[model samples]
Target: MRKIAASLAVLVATTTPASAQNAVDWFGVDGLEFASPATSFRFTDLDLRDPHVFLPITIAPFPTICFDFTDNAIPTTTVSFNGNIQASYNSDSSPADGFLDASSLLWFRPLAQDGRVARVDNGGADCLAPAPTSGCAPSATAVATAYAYASFAAGTCLSSLPGTQGSPAYAPAIASPAGSCFVTAPKTFVFDNNGTPLTLIDAQIAASFNGVPATALSNGLLRGFLRESDANQIVISDPALPGGSVTLAGPAGRRQRQLFHAQRQGHAPGRERLVVLFQLQRVPGDLHRPLSAFGDHVRFTEDTR
Candidate 1:
């Protein structure tokens, strides 16, 4: 009996799928867009002329990369490209600890109006159009499938579970017209002959604001983007960094109005609060052009540092 049980256990172990052993699920929106550019509000600025940027974000929490999953009849509706799973999550959006917290799922083509999660699957169903050769996803190597991002704000009320959304010292998706910290510093720069930036620094760092006082640093509204120090919204290749070097540049993402975002919060007297509108990411071209990823609606967490 022991021998037989041992053999069965080995068979069961071999037959079990690898995914069954995992516990972590990774789905973070690496970069987001919120509002139109400076030239927005014009009727003609339909955002149709820009090249779409589909960034494949990778989070280290889970072993596998984040992919799309549609559970039926839940508030997590990341529906699209048509297999059209009937699922939804309770997208009752509101602020939690000053930041935008909700259950909005993301889908390509139409922007998300509810839910908190954003998902991306390898596009496949687009090939199943009436013409048979729809050239979508797997059928075509490169498909310009545009997706709608989550829109949030510095919500007035708190979410049901305010404790879950962990408040970090430095949070993102927040900016301000008041401090204009980014405008005052020399954060943005052009690429030199060696494919390296002339000067790259963070907008949030204290030293960047050389003339500003400690009271301002301690109490001012700052750009909450964690990567603003090196990787701005308009990402590019830098030879100086270990893996940021860009050998060949591809077509740039729509530089105009791809900024999607939401979240903002009040700061403590000696801490930081966010005031930006939202988040956005443009392509790797034109690093010299100053772009701030349109800022952040931001849950402004108090950055103690």
Candidate 2:
């Protein structure tokens, strides 16, 4: 009788489930916003033939805007906006790469702007004319608000069991031979307040798993958001209502390679490159929704190149 009681007690203890921890809210009540630090302008002076001498041209600053929507208890997503205007003069025909040429003069202009909003003017004087005597009639052209929703294949928890010889783990683990966590859901997007979806041309997220224990991964993860230095891409898809999709493949779409390099130096030897292919589509009249619905596929592979 004593042995039977002991056995029953052990079975109950082993079968009792582990209470799940509260979901880590990377996004707070108010979503986050990322804007360009500053705007820059480049000017060049070209000595034209005789009368057409000392032509002044300006290159506008390239600005990047981003918004994150991790507040929802469901899927997570993000949106990004970026644009630039470049101009240059080719005197020697040696392939002008849009950089400041030694024989050319470059001028820089700084503009104070917000990433959450976009501003443009119509029906204005030609600022680029040979001689401009009046300022252009500036007006607000368009405005938009963007955000993202993401879901991990291994749920929100940071740890998972180690992978087998043929199939490795997708979520990070505490012990040796950690597994990787993939973004199971598509990175959804939403444009709010009668905003044009095309106002945002590109979006991406950079995640780093630097040997930090699973419990601590979500502590300060918000601060790890990617910035301008991560080499982002521009949207090339045709403009459509509600939303559209674009794919970033090959060298043009690569991101956060340096983080993988650092991990290779001393961290776990697990695969570093996690490829997440996103296909974005409009939610149709669901402007209130934080992000549109779409499908995503993830893969763990080596650098083929």
- Candidate 2 lDDT over residue span 1-305, tens digit each: 11111111100000001232113233332222322221111112111010000111123574321111111111122222111001111121123332211110100011111112121110101121221111111112211122222223232222221221112322221121112221111122221211222111122221212232221111111001112222233232323311343322222233223333332333234322221211111111222111111112211111111
Q: How displaced is residue 118 in candidate 2, in Å?
A: 20
Q: What would the per-residue lDDT of candidate 1 be over residues 198-224, giving only the tens digit for each residue?
A: 222222211011122211111111122
TM-score versus the correct structure, for each prediction: 0.16, 0.17
| Per-prediction CA RMSD (Å) | 26.1, 25.4
> What is the TM-score (0 to 1) of candidate 1?
0.16
The lDDT per prediction is 0.18, 0.18
What value does the lDDT take at residue 99 in candidate 2? 20
Superposed by TM-score, candidate 1 places the C-alpha of residue 268 at a distance from the truth, in angstroms, of 38
Off by over 4 Å in 2: 1-84, 88-134, 142-233, 236-249, 255-305
The C-alpha stretches of model 1 lying farther than 4 A from their native spots are 1-171, 177-305
